[model samples]
Target chain A: MLGGGFAEAVTPLNLLLCLTGVILGTVVGVLPGLGTAMAIALLVPVTFQLDPTGAFIMFAGVYFGGQFGGATTAILLNTPGQSSSMATAFEGFLMAKNRRAPQALATAVLGSFLASIVAVTLVVFFSPLMVNLAVGFGPPEYFALTVLAFLATSAVVTGDMLRGLSSLGIGLAVAMVGIDEQSGAVRFTLGSTQLLDGISVVVVTVGLLAIGEVLHVASRSRRAPATETVASGRPWLSRRDLSRSWRPWLRGTALGIPFGVIPAGGAEIPTFLSYGTEKSLSRRRGGGDEFDRGAIEGVAGPEAANNATTATSLVPLLGLGLPTSATAAIMLGAFQQYGMRPGPLLFTQESDLVWALLASLFIGSAMLLVLNLPFAPIWAKLLRIPRNYLYAGIVVFATLGVYTTRSAVFDVLLLYVIGALGFLLRRYGFPIAPVLIGVILGPLAETSLRRAMAMSQGDVGVLVDSPFAVALYSVLVLAVVVSLVLRARNRRRAA
Target chain B: MSASVHRTTPAGESPALGDGARSFWTGRSELFVGVLVIALGGFLLIRSAMMDVPSSVSFLGPRFFPVVVGTLLAVLGVALSVRTLLPRSAATADEAGGGDGSAVSSAESDSAEAGARSDWKPLLLTGATLAAHLALLQTAGWVIAGALLFWGVSCALGSGHKLRDLGISFVVSAAVQLAFSAGLGLPLPSGVLVGVF
Candidate 1:
């Protein structure tokens, strides 16, 4: 299966798409305001014509390549493109400031490449086990899983619990628009023929992530973006640099895997944790002012952690049909767009597509390394393009991407309305991920819970009867408790 | 008109923008959002209550999940309102070694760094452009509508050379039309150019 997957992925069409995705991801990653999620969102609609395997292959490239681009910007420009790259910017920028940008870029590329390869390799081996676990999942277990997905995503993504859940509420509300699938009752459609088909996931995602982002950036202060120049050199590692980075790369991978599987709000936690670990470890080793100075370990660790999570997060999305992050959520939408659900059963049913996607991850990561490593200085030049033209192009693509989905101008109009909501949400301090998550997962979650309830004659206790459901609830409770305790301890320290 | 970008400043500039800034609502957004959510929740609950249930066997009907979501949304709205009104501790303590980054000030800080003063001019311009694009999409078609959108947004974002931006926009839309049409087999509306392609 793996060998067949590799043969399919290496096809000219898939390879070209993979390259295109990698390049697009890197471009967005280097430029601020464009995130990996938004990049994927724009493509979800545009890639509507491609086979699922090819579309996913591109998505994976964008996912991996965005990190490389984000790290470059973080290092050279002192601005992390996404939250996942924040820790990378701290030490990465410092390294650039000290005239070590090439080394920093090199470390990031190597680290990201190694981390993704490690994580994807693990997927190649253990996905069957995950499939077996997923096959056992009844509706109740699935319901509990979605519940954990929502609570954990919100809890981890935002500072305020109320705001986080509120974001989810917004998504759930949007999802509830259109007809009830079971009852044949049109719920939120106020009487337009267009309203009958419920909002498309592509429309919702493109609106929020793409068009909404354009408006959000427009609303912000347009101060000139300042970035450090990527020093012109071959972005190759030195002997000491290689030795210093490999350990952190491995450590970051280890730290990142659990978070990716658990859906604890993408890579933000693990990246920070890896950075902290590297900082303290450096101190213990009595490295001289390396924390304040450009520490290679710092950039290496977090970049590795960030990319590792991007790779491993797919496990839950593919293996269990659960999305652990916004990108994964959008990808799940992409899967459903293809008239398929990604689960272990998918491995058996549509094994070709699933295995092909997995195989392309390897090729995609290698392509990212090759594309980003030597040409770090060139990709950095993308930032020099006026922010206006970049955003303007995004607006065009967002329109085209959405309009192409169903070829309906009405859908384009719906895109703008949702885009306005997206702009409003981002303008305020609301998290956008939950809205997308809710739109995609809300229907599935509702159905699963309803099915479980129906099977058990409306006994609420049935939700907790399964050991898997109980374990999911326990994990969720533990996460909440841990976060609360941490907050309290921090408050005491502050006082 | 130029100094209107700084809405807080006293010196007169763009009255159009000053009015927009006022109407758009600033500073009390949390309250606005809270109220909006509550109203939405109320609407949801009322709708679900009035919804026709199809009779079938073993359990909770379709209304059950809507009720749960609606009630929780209202509860969340109330929580948001209360939090906004009250002075809360530990909100400020989010940064001081909060153990897990996600546990305290992780993503909020990252996103907050991007948002500063709400500059309404560009946003309003972009919004108007979007409206125009939507209106033109069916009649003027994807090529023209897309070009207008691209050029208009570029203008909003501070590009001054109109003809250059328009040329580039046309080139972009045409290229997209050709690629999507030929390569992917998705037919973009040609509008006036219907038979030309």
Candidate 2:
């Protein structure tokens, strides 16, 4: 099956699609205020005409390329393309500032490549087992899983728990719009015929990440400080840099793969975890480690972790029909558009498509490495473009992307409204990830809860009946408790 | 542009004055966010109540989840508001430090100062441009409306090169129009220049 999948993915047309997708993804990822989610959302309309396998192969390429490409901007410009790259920006940007732009870029690329390869390998091997486990999950278990997702994302993603919860609440409220699925009752449409189908996630994602980011940038009084671009030397790691990076790379991969398997939104948590781990390890080493000042381990570990988590996030999306991030949610929408459902049955029902997608992941990872490594310097030069024209181009693209989705002017209006909300969220320090997660998962959670309730005939005990539910609930409790404890400890230390 | 406006105030005088001003604003901002959340919750509750569900539906009707979510939101909003009103707690102080156990209040003050300095004109202009583009889309076509939007955003962002910006916007909009409509078959409105392209 693996061999056959590879053969399918390696076709001339499919390979061409993969290259186009990756190149597009790189361009978007390198630009500040544009992200993988926005890129994927924009690509969906274009991919509508393609076959499922070919389209998905391109998406995989885009996904890998976007994740890897973000590092270039983060390193050179001190501006992350997305929040997941925030950790990369922390140390990688410092490295570039210290005149090691080439080294930082190379470290990021190699780390991403290595972790992606490991993650894809894990997916190829462990997906069957995951599918079997997922097949056993009923409504109660699935509801438990979503609860876990909500708790994990809201609790872990943001620094302020209250703000995160508020963001989550706002997202759930947004999700509640349009007609109710069960009773055919129109909930929050406010007598608009166009909104009966609900606010499209494409519009929401593009609005928040793209349009909102542009607004936020525009509102800033001070432009970003001029970046010091040095002549990038040959992209290679020293013997010392290699030896130092390898362990962190492996550790980051280990830390990141599990996050992907679960619906933990994006790679934000794992990348942070990797960075924190590398920082502590370097600190303990205590001899010229330079952990605070552009440590290579700091860049390598988090970059690897981010790409690894991105690759593995597909496991849940593919095998369990759960979308952990905004991009995944959009991909899930794409799946539905084709009248194909993703889950345990997907493997059997659409075996060829699944294989081709899996095969494309490997090919895309390799393609990303080939494209990014040699061109890291050129990609960094994207920052030299005039800010006005760059941002103006983004606005035009964003408008076109949103308008093309449903050709409804109402969506364009909604886009600005959501963009305003996004700006406020950022200004007030509200984490945007939970909102996207909630919008994606809220309906599924409601459906699952209702199904569970109907099954038990309002007994309510059915929610905790299964062992899986019990285990999931226990984990949720543990996660909340641990986060609370950590918060208290940090507070005490601060005091 | 306005390089003279970038001159820094005397460091000591500004920090002391800024801190006094910032704390008050931060506290009020938190309260405002809380009130907004509570209001949204109330709206959701009212809207959910107005939802006409069929009597045939069982215990888990459409209103149950919305009501629950609204109630939770309202409660959380109150908590957030109360927390903001109370004297500064150590936990929140730590949170203001960026949660890394570093510089207690400086990080908070820096970001607050940055926020204070934000210029809203560009944001407003961008919003206006989007609105105008959407309004003109049907009457003016993709090329004209999109180019106008592009030019408007460029001007808003402080681009001085009008002719250059206009040329770029025209080329970009036309290129996108061609790619999406001609290449991909996505129907874009072709208003005034309907037959020309």
Candidate 3:
């Protein structure tokens, strides 16, 4: 069913590129304040200078490479290298503190790498089926889907649904800032020429996540000291760890792919849902005691789900121009940079690049596994870096990165402002993920909504007229009610 | 030896901030954030009203999207603020009690102090150096700013010594520059000295 030459096309050079990307990605991933976005931003300009295939190969490698690498910091250190790794931190850190760092790290890497490969394979083989599914989508359906996405936003992004939902609203408002496409009138731009094109998602992402993280670290510098050593545990998976992990790994993959396809706030939801599911299903490990205390399944399922969802997230991004997560949003930028438009057409138009990229996925996983699994102890050493200095460096890198993107002093200033805002949002319990989801998806959602409305002569009824749209709306309504009911029920039960 | 600040917290909860402070930090701040969001929404709504939003048939127009988003933001912001203000009863509290399952005894507190012995100078020093890097990169060039950034952050994050950290930062930045600017061909900003060899 597959071509031999294509499989073997992963030559030494391809391997070298994959290895280099994974290594660089891992280093960046292990570090705080930097993530796939920063990594991609720094690396994107370089993709232009190399062979398209080789460059794409490396980009694909680094893309997943960053995902795999982010988990290292999430588990070993409390800081997540990427936002997607946040759910991993919820349970992974507990395992680390319980002297089970080895198993936790192992399961995380293996789960991530394995799930990515599976998802990549699915993309390669079943992409056409996915496109067919996406083709059936209509404007009303999209609107309903977005509502469902919003419903899950609070649950996936933050501990409190209200905060997450509020954040989502703020995001939609930010998305509204540019021109009114249908009316051709300026809405929120207050007469700045730069506001004509709207704020670049690149600028917002780099500023909010990268710059925000830097400022956050700086605030803590005065109050906290930095440490140089992490948990000195054997990084290799023990047999007991292996025995506890395999089932959850499978369960995680199943949970991840469905949620990923549904467009409900990215992998975070699946990871959290997986965590909650595993926490419940877990047999009382210590004879009547709950598994929350150093429970291996806590680490295993969520980590697996995190990877699975991240991998499967590509389905929507490629099949439809929809991005459910921030990383996917950035990846959409990457596709645009290459002058490739995503949607149903991408599968046919960019078939070679798609396959080659898929090939690189398998290669990237192998490299990450080799790097992370065997050399996890070496990565653990990175936590030994002093926090103040680490954060201070983040400030420097974030500034330099923003400056390089546009070479404007204003951008640097923007970075600092964003950094401070990020610190405040984080210091409070406001989740930063929605802000990103907003910045990235906001424009598209608004444009689609307005476009759909205009087509129907401003009839709100048309949005629900389509059966597919009606079904989607029903799902959204169901999600909101179910989650609310579940929360109230949980509260009652606990009471 | 300087004490480490980040790792000293036994779990997500910071001992430095007590329960009242923690609740206020999380709760009151949510309310404040809600107000700020509502205000931003109002500003957007006002701006949309001023714009010449062209109308359509018997349904909504361009203003509809912004209006809907703003209204939702305002309503949700109010809900969030109100929720934060209300104190939860004992029953709901237990459900939210998921923290890292570490019992930090008084004896463990002493060990935590022992584990925290790392300096804060590197972090502060790096921040200042980075500020200098940004201020001077245009005049001094990429080599200086880039290297300073690398060296500064490494030092601030607590590398063992200046000599070793300086060497690593220099080599790393230089290699990055060569790969990015020379090999791949995306020209980095050289600041003030443009085209002057």
Give the number of the best model, judged by DockQ.
1
For every candidate, give the share of true A-B contacts it also has. Answer: 0.46, 0.42, 0.28
TM-scores of the candidates in the order shown: 0.93, 0.90, 0.77
Provide DockQ values for all models, in the order shown: 0.37, 0.32, 0.20
For model 3, the chain A TM-score is 0.82
Summarize candidate 2's per-residue lDDT along B1-197 as a digit string, tens digits. Answer: 00111222212213334666754444334466788889889988998989888877886999988998899789889977776666655325634533121110101112333333346688789888988998999899999999999999899888989999899899999999999988988888989999988
User: Could you tell me the TM-score of candidate 2?
Assistant: 0.90
Off by over 4 Å in 2: A89-100, A238-241, A263-265, A279-286, A289-295, B1-27, B84-117
Among these predictions, the greatest TM-score belongs to 1
Q: Tell me the spans in candidate 1 whose CA falls farther than 4 Å from its real position.
A: B1-26, B87-112, B193-197
Chain B TM-scores across candidates: 0.74, 0.72, 0.54
Please give, for residues A1-495, the per-residue lDDT of candidate 3 as tens digits: 225325633778877887888887777777654666567655654455556667667766776767766677777776666656766776777777777777788888888776777777776666667788767776666666556555555453344565566667766776676676556767788787666666655566666666555544543434443232255666667787788788888888888877666656556567777877777777544422446566777777877787777677777777777666656666776676566767777767776766676677777887788788868757756766665456545555556556665666656655555555554555444555566666656656666676677678777787788777777677767766776677678667866
lDDT of 3 by residue, B35-91 (tens): 877787788678667777555422456677788778877787777666546654431
Model 2 chain A poorest 10 in a row by lDDT: A222-231
Better of 2 and 3 by TM-score: 2
Q: In model 2 chain B, which range of ten residues has the least summed lDDT?
A: B101-110
Q: Could you give the candidate ranking by TM-score, starting with the highest?
A: 1, 2, 3
